[model samples]
Target: MQPNQHLRILTISSMLMLVLSIYMVFVYAPLEIVMGAVQRVFYYHVASGWIGALAFLITLICSILYLATRNLKWDHVALSSVEIGVVFTSMNIVSGSVWARPIWNTWWTWDPRLTTATIMWLLYAAYLMLRQSLENPQRRRTFAAVYGIVAFVSVPLTFAAIRIWRTIHPVIIGSSDPSAEGNFEMTPPMRNAFFFSLFTFTFLYVTLLWHRIRLEQLTVQVAAMQSRLLNKLST
Candidate 1:
């Protein structure tokens, strides 16, 4: 099959799975006796956070490859991944705040997990800004690759914050600290729904990353064309 055919299949599959995941979250999964309806957000909340970390991991790998081979394509992939990573990280943070409002008695806190996550978001946001502010394309790409590599330090730090520090954030799949707030046991149905959401979000990420990389490629081609046209006019 052709490449477009693959993308088409993925797009359709992602859409269907997303709808099914929503159903599983709301209807299939049993509600938490404690948190009530608000517990439903946990399905997508952890899923988006997984994607945020996954995207940055991909960026880290691509950035390393770009540095090793000096290939522009790796730089493109790194940049595209960062763009997607930032958006999903935003979703993760917002959703977490939404879930926290009632449980934590406030919308935000200075908990270790939350603090590291916010810092990670800001670091990548700065990466995007740095790329756009540079005048030279090659310099921007090279510098961004280096920055992407270094910024990934925040990803692991954010992930480990709850585990390593005294924080109020609950670790969903693992043991939570005694002070952790909003902790609850996952029913079998909740596990199925939560895992399915993770799979669906991953599928959605692949689809979005493909489209974003294609757009970046097209932008580069258009810039090349414009440069050639300007040269011809000068002659």
Candidate 2:
């Protein structure tokens, strides 16, 4: 199949899955006895958070490969992952804040999980800015790769912050601290919807990443063509 055809299929599938996920969340999933309708946000919120972490992991792997091989393609992959990570992480943070308002009685808090998450987001944002500041392509790739690897350290720290330290943030899957404010048990249908949301978001992430990589490849091709044209004109 042609590239455009493949992309079209992916686009259609992603949209369908997304629509199904939304219906599952609002319609299929049962209302929480305590949190009521707001509890539904947890599905996509956690899914986005997972995708954010997954994106950082991909960045770290690409950064490693770039450093070892000195391949600019890997740098492109790393940059793309960081860009996606930032988008998903921003979604996670905003959705968490929205979910927290009614449950925690405040839109913001300095809890360990929240604090580390904010720091993680800033770290990746700085990664993009660092690339922007550098003029030399080699220097930009090297520095960005190193920074990307180092920045991923924050991902694990952010995830473990809630598990290791006391926090008001609720733990959904595992044993949470007794003092956690918004923890709740999931019913069978909620569980199904939750897992399906995860699957849907993961599929979406792969689709987006594929397109981003293709865009990067096109960008490199364009730059090369421009350089060759300039050289010919000068000759």
Candidate 3:
């Protein structure tokens, strides 16, 4: 297939899967008895959370490649991954807030998971800003790679801290037992919807990452061309 044809096919498939996932979430998935419509937010919430983590992991991997090869393509991948990860993670945090408002009785809380997510968001924010401060593209890429590795190491630790904290304030739900508040037993359909959403979002992430990396490559090419033209004119 031609490159444009292949790109079009991937775009169409990504969009179709996204639409199906949305349909499953709103139409087929049953409303939680306790949280009602609010619990439905968990579909996007968890999916975004998963994708965000995956993006950071990819960023770390791309960082390794950049350091090993000093290739600008790896830098583009690393930068795009972090940027896209930030976008999805931001959505995850906001959707978590929407769900938490009714269920947790607040829009924001100091809970471990919530707090760690916020920190992860800020760390990437700083990473991006650090990249912006450098004038040299090579230096920016190397610096960002180092930061990516450091930032990724903290993701698991943040999760572990939050999980441990949630153990104390856990609420009981969907069970006669008092210790199971957040645990909603899923019907088969709901399970299907949840997993389907996850699969769809993973594909969506892949599509977006590809597009973003392409954009970065184009931007770099334009920059190099402009520099060459200026040098020619100066000579």
- At residue 4, what lDDT does model 3 achieve? 61
CA shift of 119, model 2, Å? 0.4
Clashes of each: 0, 0, 5
Poorly placed runs, candidate 2 (over 4 Å): none
In model 1, where is the ten-residue run with the lowest total lDDT?
1-10
Write candidate 1's Cα lDDT for 1-235 as tens digits: 1258777888999999999999999899998999899999888889999999999999999999998999988998999999999999999999999999999999999999999999999999999999999999879988999999999999999999999999999988889999999999998999999999999999999999998888898899999999999999999
lDDT of 1 at 53: 96
Give the candidates in order of TM-score, highest first: 1, 2, 3
Instruction: TM-score for candidate 1, please give it.
Output: 0.98
Kindly list the per-residue Cα lDDT of model 3 for residues 146-177, writing each as its tens digit: 99999996678655653455432232222232
Least accurate stretch of 10 residues (summed lDDT) in model 2? 1-10
Candidate lDDT scores, in order, read 0.93, 0.93, 0.82
Spell out the clash pairs found in candidate 2.
Answer: none
lDDT of 1: 0.93
**Which candidate ranks first by TM-score, i.e. highest?**
1
Q: Which candidate, 2 or 3, has the higher TM-score?
A: 2
